[model samples]
Target: MNEQQNKKKWLRILGNIFFYGALLLLLFNPTAKGWFLRQLMEVGLFRPQIEQEAAMPKQPAVATAFAFRDATGTMRTTADLKGKVVFINFWATWCPPCIAEMPSLNDLYQQFRDDDRLVFLFINEDADVQKAKAFLQKKSYSLPLMTNTGQVPAQIFSGTLPTTLILDKDGNVVFRHEGLAKYNSASFVKQLKSLL
Candidate 1:
């Protein structure tokens, strides 16, 4: 009986250690944390509201002064994107939330990639451009990677890790969502089509 009790005690101890170890890994590891958050997103949490025309808030136009350098060394500005529906996402390589939502954002980009009226900008906030590029390549994501070339207007982005903004054809900021969101939802795609 004593031997059986000892065996049971060891099993309980092992289970506790495994549980605590995984908890610690989730807390300390950025990649693991991102994967966990992504699972939450897959389960239908943190979805952005793609409102219909009647429910859409009337947001005023913001100044179009943001400039960015693309991976191919081409300079693009909000001015260049005038008369088009622009989708801009500000993110960083080190941000777990940004990593968590990238797959959904990439899916959304793929859907509108061939549409000339719609533009997608995946702006990287990392100090190292090479690292950002490598991250995308490693993940097999073909997002239009861009880096800031000048001052970013505060109204468009205020240092949020995963800030998403949508501009109408007339350069108005029509939609803004901060933090992780599943952007490839059917409603979101329909809304973008309506804007186009």
Candidate 2:
């Protein structure tokens, strides 16, 4: 082959190698990082998320409700809280997935807060009033809130924490979450909007 043709062939081969190698790297490291960095994050930073969910509320938690306040000053009772979609999330201060997922839940609630057809009652499984209050204050959460304070048993929880329990308008538990869920996830919003 001519010298120029050979040189062109070499350039094309090198270009193909670079392109295919980059594609392979992307395929192996789906976390938008290098494969090794992704693996490091999974083992280091992301492990806490998994560990937190694992440590979250387990055992049964009762379905009873107590009076609580929403973002507004109005009093809210379980009975009064019914209708539309009721997402009763029972979480504690220490649950990793619970904390990770609350921001999403808060966003979801705010998006639908003005809608009269929904109630996102984030129930605290903690009996300690002061601690719960401090935690809420620190987070600056303003959603409708309540606490069991031992009126409910852990046995009522289906032995899982980080469960986002969705109730129908009738207050029946429709869906339960046992893991981290995108608070404003498309599927979650769609399900909630559908119920409303």
Which predicted model would earn the best lDDT? 1
Instruction: Give the poorly placed runs of model 1, Cα more than 4 Å off.
Output: 52-64
Tens-digit per-residue lDDT, 72-182, candidate 2: 435566656565656777777656556666666778788988988876777776566567668778888765666644344343355466666665666555555565566
Cα lDDT for residue 147, candidate 1: 92
Which residue ranges in model 2 land beyond 4 Å of their true spot? 1-77, 80-82, 149-156
Candidate 2 TM-score, true structure as reference: 0.57
Which is the leading candidate under TM-score?
Answer: 1
> How does each model score on TM-score?
0.92, 0.57
Please give the lDDT score for candidate 2. 0.60
Cα lDDT, model 1, residue 67? 84
